[model samples]
Target: MFGDLMGMMGKLKETQEKVEATKKRLDTVLIDEQSTDGLLKVTITANRSIKSLKIDDALLEDKEQLEDYLILTLNKAIEKATEINETEIAAVAKDGMPNIPGMDLFK
Candidate 1:
């Protein structure tokens, strides 16, 4: 029984390393998304932090429109980032990944 438990712990360590490597890969895959009009756009990391934002020169003329576009585009970027994280984490977690406190299980 002790041997089996040790083996499981080793396997868990391997999985944890793999997940860390995967997360490092995600840092390289920045997500960029824009609204339909291209008046606003945002870049984000898989961890859901905004990297940057852009706005069209024309949209600058209307402050209210620019604000609205910023909000809309930001939401789109964040949603896309969430999807990206989920897809990646799910793919790796197919083999009974361990769950630790504060780990982004769903990613």
Candidate 2:
């Protein structure tokens, strides 16, 4: 029993390390999103950090329109990034989890 417990603890620690590494890797995974009209483009990392923004000159002429575009496009980009991040982390965690009786975490 004690040996099993020790192994489980080690596996958990390893899973934690993998999760952190995956998060760091996600920083390099870029997600790009553009407005429907292609007037505004955004590049963000899977970690949800903004990398760059490209705005057309026409968008620059109207403050309100620019704000609206930014809000809509950025939200979409963030949603994509969040999905990637969560899926990657969950896969890592689920793969590393020890199979304990009556514990079906991944399901």
Top candidate, metric lDDT: 2
- Give lDDT tens digits, candidate 2, residues 6-106: 99999999999999999999999999999999999999999999999999999989999999999999999999999999999999999999999899989
C-alpha lDDT of residue 8 in model 1: 64
Model 2's C-alpha root-mean-square deviation from the true structure amounts to: 0.6
- Model 2 gets an lDDT of 0.98
For model 2 the local lDDT of residue 12 reads: 97
Please give the lDDT score for candidate 1. 0.80
Q: Encode model 1's per-residue lDDT on 1-107: one tens digit a residue.
A: 68777776887888777777888888878988898987787899997888888877999899998888888888888888889987887787645455445766555
List clashing residue pairs in candidate 2. none
Question: Candidate 2's error at 88, in angstroms?
Answer: 0.3
Q: Which stretches of candidate 1 lie over 4 Å from their true place?
A: 96-107
